[model samples]
Target: MTRSLHDRHRAVLPDWLALYYREPIEITHGEGRHVWDASGKKYLDFFGGILTTMTAHALPEVTKAVAEQAGRIIHSSTLYLDRPMVELAERIAQLSGIPDARVFFTTSGTEANDTALLLATAHRRSSQILAMRNSYHGRSFSAVGITGNRSWSPTGLSPLQTLYVHGGVRTRGPYAHLSDARFIEACVADLEDLLGHTRDVAALIAEPIQGVGGFTSPPDGLYAAFREVLNRHGILWITDEVQTGWGRTGDHFWGWQAHADSGPPDILTFAKGIGNGMSIGGVVARADVMNCLDSNSISTFGGSPVTMAAGLANLGHLLEHDLQGNARRVGGLLIERLRAIGAQLPIVREVRGRGLMAGIELVRPGTDEADPQAAAAVLEAAREGGLLIGKGGGHDTSVLRVAPPLSLTVAEAEEGAAILERALRAV
Candidate 1:
């Protein structure tokens, strides 16, 4: 009977579709940092649905808002603005401190990025875009174009005209022992050279904290220097906050604020946690730039009432519960513990990242080469031990991504670290 059901399920879902390799357990329900499989076996969710569930699964307030809004209205075309949409946009703009910022919402992070790229090129009338090496933006055509990973492209596909700049001078990882001054200088020089070489560059796009790129944070002064260069070249700086926004970083409400010493970017894109796993993403642009765009660019399903309600509720919960503070406190404990573990384990190369968005880079014993096999072993072992984690990096298998919900407790963080240590030992 089980075999027959599995066969039927596989038949219903198209076989040609890309398969995201999942564990054998079929997850049926989730709450606060835990998930249950079909057999009622509970597992600790360290990945938090790839960092999209910022608040946690089925949060009470978010669910209530979603239920109320669903009863009222679901969606209306952009032809008419609704109360929830208006209020949600206002809250986002206030939180971001981007005055009179105009928001254009989408159903997913990829679409949000695609729309932002379109707006950038449309406003500037430029075709060239600058992106950093090892960056992972999104999967849409234009987004894929600016993404630095060549492996993301399919066979026989032509590469986009986007110029690439080295993230840091040291070919080593972002945490390598290098002077901040030298690193920023090298990055600025590269940007200047790239801008000088390429004509009609529309924007320079980057993630505040590099998510898939080993969860790397650039040198201290890198953003300020980059902003100066973009200003000189008359190009806009677009910050992709899809993975880092919504107070996941702990120190600030938005990741960009962590680098507030640097001037704000011209366009900021957010998704993932904005609606706490509800399908909603937004692009907040300067008033002048948004006003310059034509009305025909609006999306039919952007900022639906249900999505806005969910987003608003999520934001309110974050502020009311002081979840960002919890992220900082618990994340600090997790980082310290992981670093201690890495100090003893030869395979654990580095433990890096801010707040809840963190990564552990696995390396071969006694070699600098990435041990993707070992990383996979650790991940599998963690799953077997009732913990779920995600993977990120250029190899897609080297960095063990750990992004628990902001509501995670210190005790839970300790338990997760202990599980990770055991998994590392088994590997």
Candidate 2:
């Protein structure tokens, strides 16, 4: 059944849209942290649909909210005042650390990022942007221009001229040999020096944790240090929290909180997981920055009633249950277990992540070279073992991405870890 569907998908879908596994299975349904394929094979989902499933599959709260909202009204566009939209925005504005924050809704992380770029460039009156190496922002033309990952970037043409910065990846860069303090110093020096050669850089956009770049994160206070320098030039800081937001990163509610010394970013973009598979993405910025645009703009489907209802329900459940605390406690244990599994494996280079998000980078046995082939083998093996995972990294997709739902239980984590261990061994 999946084979014929795959053939149809290949015939119609864009070739660039990649699918997982050699023989990709059709996910017919899911409950909690597990999903079933068309063949009725049950598998533990570790990747959470590329971390979009923030809460859980078939979550009752989100499903009920969506159903009720759809029954009333699915969409009214931005021309009408929406109660659910207003409520979710209010909650987000309060949660976003930006004072006097304004929220703008979009349909996906790509749109959220595009809106951020538009706001930054318009407010600062410059098309120049500073991005980090090994970062993955989104797929929009504006987003691709700023993205530092070659694998994800499909075009050189972009509306903004972006400069790539260091310090996104901690273990495999020029400053990899340095202590965390020294590494931050070097990256800061690079930023300062780069600024000297450029002018009117609107904003420096970074993913608190480089999601598609194998969940790599810099030192805790690196961004805060960078914030000090950006402050000197009046450059805005934009944090992409699409994957790392909403307590996914165990230790902090938002990934930027890890570098909270400088307070929050000037602009924040988020999508994926907030709606628990519902399409919801948004940007929060200081009122001045958000209102800088002279003309009106509205997303036709952005703040639709149904999506907003999902967001409201999802966010409510997340906070009420203290899922952030759960992420911290459970994610810590998962990471420790993964590190133990990696210790004895020659193919495993490093295990890094915080909260429910973790990455295991694969390398050739006896060398430091990235082993993309090994990653593929493990992915296939994991699938055979009834486990679903994801792979991502730089040019070579050599890292195994393990990000289950925020509500993932301790037993689920252990089960997934055991399956992953066997998969790793098989590969």
Candidate 3:
């Protein structure tokens, strides 16, 4: 008899490659917000492949664009002029909100962030960087160097000297009990104090809304406050929008827009949702910072025509349908529903997030300590109830992640929430 797929996977893959459940699933196909496993069980896909499926699954517009472009030309390396690459870059640059913005394509968020660090360090002539605590950038060596989340960071050695700052997480930090305004002030003061101890900081890279840190975010205008301080010292600000871009957050097109008083970041990096599941990542920076590199560099498959075409079509569809507004309306109702459900359950310490990206923090009943076991139970129970969600947090993995496609409907949201309620109660 042939061995099972899971058995084969375990035999070949490294132990560090984590799977979701005790009996991991093999997602076979998807349509809209629902997907089917290899065993033919349908699941309401709330996680959306870690929020990469910004638009609906199997979107016709993106699929057609990818097919058409692949039929014409698939791979034209950056050595020659590429029309799709230029067109997509132009659109992204115009939308990035940075003055005289330049866009460089990459294959993943890890590479996109790596490029951002390179630009900042080279432009400022410093290897020191500032990153927020409990942040998750990407898995690349450089990206992990700046990532403050120790769980995801595998090694301590890094090319850039990284300093961790406070204020990325709200409800669990030393200043969590403060009012929103006071909390912002405290975090800003903390940032200023951190800068005092260190010099030659090339940049302060932040997620605006920490994705892997359980959807935690400081008060509104926190970054703007930090920007005022960074501006004084000529430190560049880099916004990592890998999980928050393309209207996933509902209220703002980019997560950084929530802190609009500071204007756009000096450098911005994006990935995950722009291609609607295709591997399209990029860095958008002002001309001065982007042009700082003395030598030439290029990504062979970064701006491949097929992926650029997919990005163009996916972005066009997202804007044409006004999915951002849809996210706002539907996501508001979902969050309120989650809060109602959470209020009844002591295991749910918090229900937090903006737009479609939500997190339900699990804790032991009658205690403030994190309950990762409860989180795992809820995840498995939700899967059994025909729902698919994700889990993440600082280090314990105690937060249930609920980030559906931006096009999620009110009915779908309600259905998913109901299933999640059952899962939470069951746990």
Candidate 4:
């Protein structure tokens, strides 16, 4: 007996149309941190949809909220506000500790970042924007132009005046050797130099913890120093928290809060875990900054009732379940396990990041040079062994990013580590 036409059609879809270089698995369903392929194979999703599913997949509370909101009202354009949207905004402000912050919700991280950059330029009335090297803000024209990675600049947007600051260097071991004080000094000095040369710079943007930049956390006092410089020069500080927000970092609700002693940023952008993978992003601006924007800044699909409902439900679930504490505990365990693996694996270069947002840099046996082949091998081997992971870093692709859900169990972490160990050995 042969399969039906539907099966044949699914099998024969044009490969050229799909850009993702996918593995053999065709995931059909998911619950929590596990996904099942069409062939009924179950895989542990350690990547957590690139850290977008902090509450885990198909969360019951979030699902119920989304369904109920869909039945009532899916969307009402921003022209006429909705109750859920208002409530969600209030909740975000309350959690973020920015009492006067106003949110402009968008459908994706890139759009949120675009809105933020627009605000910065509008507020400062300046053209130049400064960003950290290796930063990954988003893919939109303005956002990509500001991002330090050149690969995203292929869209041919008009070039803008931008300056880049160097993030700390990679160390040869589990942890980098540079002290937080030294790292901060270097970063602040570079920014001062750039500000001295560049006139009327509008903003300085960065990730509290660099996500696509190999999950690298900047030095401890870097935020304080950067904020001081920006304040002194009257430049807006925009922290891109797309990946580090929503309790993923454990110590704080927002990544910037990891450095709360430092003054808060002038503008903050969030998206990835805002709706627990339900597709929502937002920019929270201080009162002065928000008031500077022109009325024309609007989004048709931003802050839809459905997305707001999901965001509210996800936030409530996190608070009720104390997931942040769990993230801290479980994430520490995972990091320790990764460091242990690094000790055993000669090819392992470094283990870095905070809380659930972590990475393992792979390299050749006796050199600091990146070994992309080994990294690819580890990814493939882990996937085949029922654990899904992702990759990041420079041209090397040496970093293995592990950003599992906060709901992840110790047992699951053990399983993931075992798979990773096996993969490393195989490589």
Cα distance off (Å), candidate 3, residue 154: 1.0
TM for every model, in the order presented, reads 0.94, 0.99, 0.99, 0.93
Candidate 2: C-alpha RMSD after superposition = 1.1
All candidates: CA RMSD (Å): 2.2, 1.1, 0.7, 3.1
Task: Give lDDT: candidate 3, residue 250.
Answer: 92
Global lDDT scores for all candidate models: 0.81, 0.95, 0.94, 0.82
- Candidate 2 lDDT by residue in tens digits, 263-366: 99999999998989999999999999999999987789999999999999999999999999999999999999999999999999999999999999999999
Estimate, for each residue in 83-135, the C-alpha lDDT of model 4 and write its tens digit: 98899988887676665898888999999988888888889998788887767
lDDT value, residue 81 of candidate 1: 67
Give the clashing residue pairs of candidate 1, or none.
none
How many clashes in each candidate? Answer: 0, 1, 0, 0
- Point out the worst 10-residue segment of candidate 3 by lDDT: 169-178
- The model with the greater lDDT, 2 or 4, is 2
Task: Show the lowest summed lDDT stretch of 10 residues, model 4.
Answer: 15-24
Model 4: how far is 87 from its true place, Å? 0.3
Candidates sorted by TM-score, best first: 3, 2, 1, 4
For model 1, residues 66-114, the per-residue Cα lDDT tens digits are 9998998888867786888889888888777676788888888889888
- How far is 341's C-alpha from truth in model 2 (Å)? 0.6
